[model samples]
Target chain A: MAFENYVNSNESYTSNQFYEKLLREIPDLIFQFKIEKDNTYSMPFVSNSAMEIYGFEKDFLEHDAGPVITDRILKEDVKAFLKSVLKSRDTLTRWNHEYRVLLPKKGVRWLKGSAKPEAMKDGSVVFYGRITDITANKEQELRLVLSEKRFEFALEASMGGVWDWNLVDNTVFYSEQSMKILDLDETEGINSFENCISKVHPDDQKEYLSDIDLHLKGITDVYENLHRVKGRKGTYKWILDRGKVIERDKSGKPLRIIGTHTDISSQKEREDELKKTLDIVSEQNSRLLNFAHIVSHNLRSHAGNFTMLLDLVDDIQDSSEREETLQHLRTISNDLTQTIEHLNELVSIHTEIKIARENLNLYEFFQRTLNVLSEKINKHDVKIISLIPDDIHINYNPAYLESILLNFTTNAIKYSNPERRLEITYQLTYEKGKKVLTISDNGLGIDLEKYKDSLFGMYKTFHQHPDSRGIGLFITKNQVEAMGGKIEVKSKVGEGTAFKIYFNEKV
Target chain B: MKKFNDVFVVDDDKVYHFILKNLLKKNNIEVNSRFFENGHDAIEGLKENSKNGTTLPDLILLDINMPVMDGWQFLEEFRKIKGTLNKETVIYMVSSSNSPFDLNKAKDFPNEIQDYFLKPVCLEDICRIFLN
Candidate 1:
């Protein structure tokens, strides 16, 4: 109706001039495209804005616009652009396309062309359309796509995935990477927050729920927890789950939450390894300190004796007395060398060597030790009672086993009471899933209540026996401990002594 | 100054016993001195002396790190029976160990132990101890 009014009430221009003026006033490049009988395109009408949009002179485009227009189209999109135009012409349909173009003035720009095509009686088609400079809109759209892609890439790179939870609806949305980490197929029913929580390991659910509850209640800024998530096969993977309450109601009640799950199983394994190494280092440090104390005390005793003896040798003037004192000096010097050798041996005993173990019969080893000590046993009139079964075997280092047996049995004999007939009993039993060998002696038992702490210490003597050099039990203790065994002694003054050797045997 | 009529040298090491005996005799500081092997033997001697109405030693040289009852155990027992003794014995702890643990431990018995000495006790230490 407006067009009719304007055409009839022409001011100075005619109807064609008025229509042209209208088309040129629009903010688009309006055009009429004709496909002739030979399938060549010609733009019969084009607005003046074509010069500004396409960088073409208006007269040149109206005369022959096909070659210049096609040349300006981006090389990569030329084929597709032409194909779309032809399709629109043949189908007599609207042509709508957005494409890039290389303009003479503007280097490169995004353009949008939309037109409705109509068939004519001459077997040619025409499209009345408009083209607009959509460079800004296209750039904005591309930036949105790029930012989305960057977020996806960041999630993938961190071995983390996003999760959106709606607290009001109790629904959860998991990203593609989240599904993969949970070992879930798309069809699996994990859409509910409850269902997702069920996948948390039973042991970790308490902490996970508490962390989320705290954040939901605004007690914490973020909900974070290191938890194990159950897999499809019932195995678990450690996940560092972090989330924040993103939306809340007016009353400060959480309505929505967003979070990320990072697979931290490998990192957890490394932490465990670091902890174990620290434990081993601390253990070695303590053992080294104990060894230092032993070295200091034992060496000092020897040095002090040598000093006192040298002083006496200077004071003695009689020839026979001087000779005797010198003899004592020589004896003490030899003792000092032996003490140094023992210390060296003690230092070398603390290595982790689980090899060199042999299966040896306990009864037979005891029999051999008894046979070797028969002379001493007879001289002391000792009665030996052994209760070990012949078939009982223990896994131990053979040399250590022999030394342990010899030291303990010889100790029992040497400390036997002279008032009563000396009796030694060897018994074997099991205590707390370990083989325990008990050696009892009805002898001058030690005052264990007074000396329990230092019973097995190196160079510690508990009796005045001439043969009590205080090294046998120390060496025996070291050998037993090296073989992964422990010794416990129970004694009473003047009654008897019982030693329990607990052996660690793998069956 | 109180004269030391009776002195007890209590030690497990035979070498210390020999050295102390010669040092005392060579110095001509004559006293009725007795030697015991360890704390157990010295405690037994003290008990015997008490029972026989004999004099308890005026001075006792105590050695730590002996076989049966160590110096610490002897001091613990001595504290209980000390009130019955006729004289307050001047006790000195002599040890080969110069460890801070042993030295600090001797300081714990301020009333009982007169002093702690690191041994190979010199003639000067002997003279100072006799003076005490």
Candidate 2:
């Protein structure tokens, strides 16, 4: 009677309602298998969903499921999966393995199979297993691992370090390479934010903290700053720290930050050295311009004088006055010879002589120069008015000072209008550690607009005077610049001219 | 040779003027040789002569470099004076400058300048003027 009842219940469970409920309950194909003699397997039951998984009818797999399993299991992964299962059976433990399976009428797919061992009362071992398709998940995991390897190679090649921060836990995670960059042992724990902060220079600590705070407050999505950090060798190195907030909370608050650090000390040093070299080149260029002006002026004046005298000698005749003419000729020739010697001396002035800085009395020097030109001033009916203070002095080269003053005085006399009496005035002032000397004249002034560029050029003459050689101002400009001074002119066509010279004050 | 109403020597150098005046007297140039220290003085004299309808110089020996104004500036101003002085009067540019630039510039004023002479004007050079 009990055997009849079991058969009757199985018949009722196979009804359409019962089968429909079973298909809905288990969307995956379900099967029950029983082991036979010598490596053969038998299936007593198979669900209708088996058609969806293996593209076969349930009746075909009802007696034998081994054919489907063997046929669908990829040739390469079958041996490994079988070996794992056998080993797990000997140990009487569960088995888990991921293997590729070739589906009928479908491409190959990866499946994760897990089997549980059941102990029977007859001392026989039986196994039940479920296979879940994990093809997409396995491919994604492989791609992630490859990308990580590429990032590691790139970081190493670029000499960069990677870091990650956990905002909620206040911990920092540094990669092995990052630890190496900080000169720290890779095995040491760098799991706390304090460990990273401790390596930063004291001066940069505030800035580094502010950058992190700004990122956390959602002020910015990225933080970049340069800071010096103490390396494992206790040497300070310049590092460019760049990071972006990667993980954010629902409120758009940054939960985690990750970034890189690169050493840029050598590049920074090269940039600073290049700037210093450029400054020196510009300074030398200014000096070269002043030197060129001096050469053009001095050389052309002597040449002009020589040419004029030679032309005059060719036009003269009469033996009676020939001797007197020869004497005048000798005087002019001597002047030319002296001018050439002066030019040679001026050229040698650039031979790196150390300048002797000393205090110089302006009034005393002015008086001395005035005395030297007194006879000419008297003959020309000229008056000199000095406004310089007696105690006021400047640090300068004495010879340069004398030359500047002499040139100005002679120029004033030479260009003076014959109809009016000549008057020259000198004034001195001090400002911002600089001494300024202003020499003004009531003689014929220069047209600054038209001749400003050529005023100090060689052989440049604006006045139609016979004595104009256009060298005095040129030499004066050179002397001033050689002594670390600067000169400027202000003049109009008929009004007089004023030369303002500035010099560094002595300590 | 044709006699000129007036002759002029415009030069900055005094020795050139002295030699030129003596040469003119020896040749009996039959003209009053006027001397000017510079182009400025020479221009003033020419302007005054033009205004008064006085006889203009038949010939002018002008120097290039002079005080206040140069021979080139004198010629520019001399052209503006509207009188019967054109075509009949001849001007000679005498310069000590051997610059080819100056020679080319003189060629531009061919109507005003009859000839260009280098320094140390000699009798033979003056004779060329009479032949022209």
Candidate 3:
């Protein structure tokens, strides 16, 4: 009977040894803990894999697990680990934690630990849990958070907008700066793709949609365009939308897109205005070239005629006929002199007034001009009223300003009505940092509809006056423009005329 | 100066031609001088002379400004009329354009233009051209 009992008992002991061998062969880091009185902890079992995870012998933990907690757990995480364990002790459920743990040979590692409660018939709790080293994954997540913060700061400081799109969900992700660029509040309702399209200018809506579609179809890797968007102030702003399709799946379907928006309204406006100014200047230059040709041909012809006439007088022998020829020649010579003088004056005006710029006192300049033309003003029975301020000033060529003022005042007097008493008034007004001077006259006003186009052209005389050479206004216009100023005229047939001059105010 | 059978004055202004013709006569140039209102008529007269085998103008006073064709255009067309008269004919371009551009252009035409004279071509200028 003793021999039979020894064989059965030995077989049972062999089966138990096989069970323990099977548990040790598993790859996971397994452990068993036993709860004691006074909230102390003990490990009844620990797998050999604990050596690989904690860099310690499994026997050390199994011998005295309470000391292992303090030795292995980092100094900073020890308190929290104890508190978590104590809080979950009464729950009779699994408790888990992620904390930094120090190893005997390894420096430090990120570890996850858990424990489950087991109830015995004696009301004592026992637990089992596993520990994992997740140091690489934790480092990767930390680096990603830092890079995102840097990108957000850069975008906000540059006043740029960043956006991302999820192709699978058909949803868009916008940074805080992206909302600001759209002139929307941070708390405003989320914008759908259709809402973004509606804000684009009507002329650009089709192009905007088509570009996105092309990008989505994987036909293009990038899309960029300039479009007008309504701002918070309800005014249109020009923005450059540039984006790249970053990801595509195996079947060539777009997965994600990233882009930025930059405000370029000021630059676009400057380009447009520059093109317009260039066109105007080109047209004016061509007209001047044509005028120069006509001037050369006409002037030379008259001079040639005069010279030939004088030569004929010298060839005549009879004294009586010679004297008569000389008399006619004198008349032609006088006309030629006047024409040449007019031409010389026009040329001088173009060259001389182009070089000089100085600060000018309007009050003094106007007074001097009036003094020079006092005779004509009196002869025309004109009442001159000056409304210039003493402190007003402008940057201009002194001689040009004098010439312009003289011509305007003289013209007002010359074109005055014979039966009516002429009243010429000068008024200066400052608006929005620009100086405006208006010279109004009660005179025989011009029919602007008929002569407006040629009013400031050389040799363009509309009135039937003996002294209307038509050069004064032309020179005035050139002088004004050369000084960075402009002139505008308003008139009616019989009522009156007003000349408004706009000039930059002296700071 | 050698006298010739005829002279031609081509210009638009009647006063210029009248004065030039009388001056030529007073200087005792002793030549039959004719006047044309413009370069077109003057060229026609020259063509008629060439056909008749008569001597062309001993000296042609060419004015630059005229109604139909000017002195420069006439010179271009005159070169095409291949005749014995061309070797003997002398041409003077008279203009009132005091621009150096015009003077430089005149000098560029090597053989067609004989000389350039400014406005008021007086007796002294004419005398100098012939004497030189």
Q: In DockQ, how does model 2 score against the reference complex?
A: 0.05
- Fnat of candidate 2 is 0.00
Comparing 2 and 3 on DockQ, the stronger one: 3
Question: What ranking of all candidate models by TM-score puts the best one first?
Answer: 1, 3, 2
List where candidate 1 sits over 4 angstroms from the true fold. A1-34, A42-68, A103-114, A128-165, A169-224, A227-239, A244-255, A261-274, A317-331, A347-366, A372-398, A404-507, B1-14, B28-93, B98-116, B127-132
Specify the highest-DockQ model's number: 1
Tens-place lDDT digits, model 1, residues A1-507: 023324455366656678877777787888888888789887776777888888887566436676777789999999999999999998888999988899988989999999999999999998889999999898899999999899888898998988899889888888888888877778752388788789899989998999988988899988899999888899899999999999999999889999999989899999999998787566446545544665565567667767877877777888988887777777667767766776666666665456377899999999999999989988888899999999999998877788778888889887888899988899999988789999998889888776564566533652223346356677677767666677889998899999998887753
| Per-residue lDDT of candidate 2, residues A429-453 (tens digit) | 7757688989888888887786686
Model 3 RMSD vs true structure: 11.1
**lDDT tens digits, residue span A273-331, model 3:** 99988976774575355346435645555565566666576657789878867765775
The 10-residue segment of model 2 chain A with minimum total lDDT is A1-10
- Against the hidden true structure, what lDDT does model 3 obtain? 0.71
* Two-way lDDT contest, 1 vs 3, winner: 1
Expressed as tens digits, the lDDT of each residue in B1-132 for candidate 2 is 644557788876665555565555556665677888777798788777877887778888887756566777788777776354542677888766544545788987878898888766667776676433
